[model samples]
Target: MSKETETMKHNAEVAQFRFALIAPVIQGLFPDASATAYYKRVSAAPLMLPEGTSVKYSYKTLENGNPCTAPEGLIH
Candidate 1:
């Protein structure tokens, strides 16, 4: 397959995984938030994790369920 087709497939997979990961968090935080509302809120607000949050390598692996590097500038 072409590189463009592979990239598209990879992106689609990532989008699906991201949605799945966020769904539970959204529901927990905003019990009444529908999928539409969740998307809207996600578009509007960024996650501002407060200070003193520890970084866990296991959590990163769990999030992607694959071997990947944690995003830079994530901890402030």
Candidate 2:
């Protein structure tokens, strides 16, 4: 649609890429961790890393699920 909207989307995409790049770096410091494990830890860190860093994980979610875990939770 508009230039402003397009710019915003581009910026968001860039931020996601940057986060993904940093994720592995942060995960590498851990001992014998899987990629998914690294992603999980990285996603949680952004939750408290100031506004900009936190924005990178705005839509992040864990893949862990259960048949009886949070039957009424919206995220489940």
Candidate maximizing TM-score: 1
- For candidate 2, lDDT tens digit of each residue in 1-76? 8999988887777656554444443445533255455546655654533234554342223322211222332123
User: Model 1 — which ten-residue stretch has the worst lDDT?
Assistant: 67-76
**Cα-based lDDT for every prediction:** 0.44, 0.45
Evaluated against the true structure, the overall lDDT of model 2 is 0.45
TM-score of each: 0.35, 0.34
TM-score of 2: 0.34
Q: With candidate 2 superimposed using the best TM-score fit, by how many Å does residue 70's alpha carbon deviate from the native? A: 38
Residue clash pairs of candidate 2: none
Q: Report how far off residue 39 is in candidate 1 (Å).
A: 18
Write down the RMSD of all candidates, one decimal each. Answer: 13.7, 8.4
- 49-74 per-residue lDDT for model 1 (tens digits): 22323333333333333123234311
